[model samples]
Target: MSTINCFFNTYQRRLEDLEKKLNRDQLLVADELTSAERELAMEMVHMGLLENIAQRVFVTKQFPINDFLLRQLVLGQGVYTGNTALYLWHLSDAFPYTIQLAVRMGYQVPKQRYLEWTENVQFKQVRQPRLEEDVKKIDVAKTTRKILVYSPERVLVELIKSTETDKELLKAGIQRYLRSPQRNLNQLLMVSKRLKAEKKVQFIMETLL
Candidate 1:
């Protein structure tokens, strides 16, 4: 078969596998699979078709994927690193407990917005971030430096507004974030000044003991 034919076959297998796993009542990836299963699975990943797709599959799976790999998987990857694992390990946060994935800008939001990119998903509904939204970008250093996604000032301001109207729910979410293993307070404060809610921040600051 041609390389193009192999590529099509790869996606055909992937879609089938993904759908099968999603339909399962209780999934246990390691129960029925071993290292051999992973290699075969990787071979069918359309490796030559799209460079990113193969890399994403390998990095996301860590080991080989079988009939059990769920729709949402990834933590040991280089970009996300160990922060997520640390938080989960310590039960420090509620996020990443569920499916959590960030989409690259100028990309369309997917049907499975909380998981992987399925289609045209540019912005996340939960975040609703924008280039024109006066967001402060920060350079997060890792193996090499790269800009990480954030809305800094706007997101906090939005949360504060939500707190006034729905204090119970808003507080719960922010508190949950705070309880997480990794949170940048300095980033939060910097964002605070850029917000239009100076009075709101001041009120909270004054009330804090």
Candidate 2:
């Protein structure tokens, strides 16, 4: 017996219940459904274009998407990068770090973006994600999420500012980010202008350079 078997196997089903009611009382389902029956049901749903509306795909994890679908998803969502990511962290003091726009790439993400997020998010397109990726399709919470761009260094800087605000924390952050591969010296300098981090920035730039 399979999940979709009951749908095709039984005959005494209320049309309204079958169509509108999705609860257990929806129909007199069969004991089980065969793989063929399951596939057949999927095809019917797919052909009728009822998958999105009727069959909900609760994705919070990564999945595959061809290039065409990728473009369609990205363009449709109006996803952008830079300030979006920092916004997610709730820290926007620094100049934004633009890397990539938010879109689908059939990317495999470890975690999806959070729903009801404070700001729109963008991600960096890289090779390995966490390490860096051009596309991030994560299942954030209960929804399937995606981040097409990212800036590791900047993200690190913001995270460091959250819990540990001690001078030592900032100092350590400065030292660590000084030579970080993704560390944007230019952005850091720009942020230093408003934050009055000239001395700190200069010192780090000098050391890293």
Q: Residue-wise lDDT of candidate 2 within 58-168, one digit each (tens)?
A: 111132322222322423332333344443323343444332344344543323332212123344333332233322332233223343333433443433334533445
| Candidate 1 colliding pairs | 38-64, 107-121, 107-122, 108-120, 108-121, 108-122, 109-120, 109-121, 109-122
Query: Where is the poorest 10-residue window by lDDT in model 1?
Result: 74-83
Give candidate 1 regions above 4 Å deviation. 1-56, 60-92, 96-107, 110-155, 163-166, 172-189
* Clash totals for all candidate models: 9, 20
Tens digit of per-residue lDDT, candidate 1, span 120-189: 2223333344333442223322111222333433444555754433455444445555555544555556
Quote each prediction's TM-score: 0.36, 0.27
lDDT of 2: 0.38
Candidate 2: residue 80 lDDT (0-100): 36
RMSD of each: 12.5, 14.0
> What TM-score quantifies how close candidate 2 is to the native fold?
0.27
